[model samples]
Target: MKRIESIKNPKVKEWRKLHKRKDRDLTGTFFIEGFHLVEEGLKDKEMVNEIIITEEVSIPQHWKLDGINLTFVTTEIMKVISETETPQGIAAVCKQKLAVHPLNWSKTLMIDAIQDPGNLGTLIRTADAAGIDGVLLGDGTVDVYNGKTIRASQGSIFHIPIMKGAIGKWLPSFSERKVPVYGTALEGGEPFNKIKSSKDFALIVGNEGSGVQQDLLKNTAANLYIPIYGEAESLNVAIAAGILLYHLRE
Candidate 1:
């Protein structure tokens, strides 16, 4: 183990670069904070690039590590590299795996220009829970490689495949394949329960404030909404997605 102790170590500079989206792209790797996410990436088996550990840590007996790269750091070094307000003493750098191709997509959810990392992560977790095929990260959506996104996803990020691109342009291809594209809107929408069960459908969730893009929604085969009652306003994008996913799964 190559151990680092100084906060100003050269490796710390490299690690800190991972805090931005550009660096994650340049290095083809992203960092996951805390032990659970590190463990999650380990379980996926194909995505991890390196595991960074500190003196204050515990290793599970089942995390098989035959060929995995492991790096060691002192607590001070770990703190300087950590993304969280309170460092959890562990974080792992993982390669960004290839996005699942559109042809391979089945029942999936498309996120359109959502700006919240926490919302994006929660929706990913919910999609995994509902057995959705994958998530498409459309233009304007926060970086999936963001450390906060990884932490908020828990272990669910690995279980669901994610693709990123311009959804408005890419969705027509799904239309050509005859897959139903559903978009959510505040108006001119059907209830989520109206979604057909045991069929191929892609749900497009929009920005927290903007809702779905007008251009995309105008072309969607179906527009669905979760009803609110008792004088409530609206729901969080993640919660709305979970509700819709629950109905779709049923």
Candidate 2:
């Protein structure tokens, strides 16, 4: 394995750049840290460009590294590249596996302008767990490759198909296919359970505070809202998404 000890090394500078969304987009790669994420990235080894570990840490014996590039760095260098409070001693640079075409699946979750990285990640993880066919991230949503988002996903980001684009552009395609698209809102909306679940449908969950955009909701087959029984005003967007996704899938 090649060893890098200087923070100023050109390769180290490139790895550090992966932390920024612009740089990640420019290079077509993102940085992921920790053992679980690294293992998940390795499942599709072709997407993994390189793995970096502190000199003291050993690669797991069972991990197949036949064609993978490995690098050893000093503890100080690992700290410079890590996003966590305490470095995990291992990290990897990975190519983004974004879906290029519209999803043709039974169930889909569409996110509209969700700005929180953690919430975005949790939504992706939940969608994967609920067996949703794919996740469509609308314009104004946080970047899926954000470190907090990736960490919050707990590796599910690697398990599902994710696409990014304007939510409006995809609506017509869903309409053309006769797939019912439902939006979440408290007003002018039906209770979620009242809507008949189907084998094929799309659900749109919106911003943390505003709910789905009015124009977008107008385009949905019907708008839905989970009934609130308590004094609490509303549900966190991620929790609401989990409830609706599982229900719609059933």
Candidate 3:
């Protein structure tokens, strides 16, 4: 395996750039740190372009790296590229493989302008666990590849299909198919439990502060709200999504 020791190495600079959204977009790849995420990315070997591990770190014996590009770096270089307080001694640069179409989607979670990276990641993880067919990120939402988002997903990012675009563009298609799309809001929404469970549907959760976009809510089959039963005024976007996702899939 090739070894890199200099923090100023040209290749190290390129890897650092992967931390930025624009750079990731330009290169069509993102950086993931920690063994769990690296292993998850390996599940789709074609998408994993390179693997970087510190010289002191050992790969699991069962990991097949036959055709993969493997690189060893010094501990110092690992710290420079790592986003966490405690580096896991391993990281991988993987290509972005976003789902291109909405075909065969029975259940999906549509995120509208959610700005928190942690919230976005947790939502993706929850959707994956709830067996949602896919996730659609709407305009103004945080990048799915953000470091915090990737870590929060606990490697679920690789297990599910995710697409990003204007949420409105997909509404008409769902409308034509008569699939129910539910939006969460504080007003004009029925109790979430009132809606019958279904095998196919879409749920839209919005920005933490503003909730779902008004125009988008108007387009949904129904608007829903998890009733506030206690003194608490609201729920975290991620927690709210988990409750609704499992209920809808019941």
Which stretches of candidate 2 lie above 4 Å from their native place? none
Q: Which candidate is the best by TM-score?
A: 3
Per-candidate RMSD vs. true structure? 1.5, 1.0, 0.8
Q: Give all candidates' CA lDDT scores.
A: 0.84, 0.92, 0.93
What tens-digit string does per-residue lDDT give for candidate 2 at 1-250? 7999889999999998998999999999999999999999999999899999997888899888878899999999999888899988999999999998665766889999999999999999999999998999999999999999999999999999999989889999999899999999999999999888788899999999888999999999999999999999899999999999888876
Residue pairs whose backbone atoms clash in candidate 2:
none
Candidate order, lDDT descending: 3, 2, 1
Q: Give the TM-scores of the predictions, in the order they appear.
A: 0.94, 0.97, 0.98
User: Which window of ten consecutive residues has the lowest lDDT sum in model 1?
Assistant: 97-106
Backbone clash total for model 1 is: 0
Per-residue lDDT of candidate 1, residues 1-250 (tens digit): 5677787888789889999999989999888878788888888767887788887787778888668877888888887888777887888888887575766677889999889889988999999988898888898999987876776788788888888878987787888888888899978988877777656778899999989999999999889998898687899999999888777653
- On lDDT, the stronger of 1 and 3 is 3
Off by over 4 Å in 1: none
What is the TM-score (0 to 1) of candidate 1?
A: 0.94
TM-score-sorted candidate list, best first: 3, 2, 1
Model 3: colliding residue pairs? none
Number of clashes recorded per candidate: 0, 0, 0
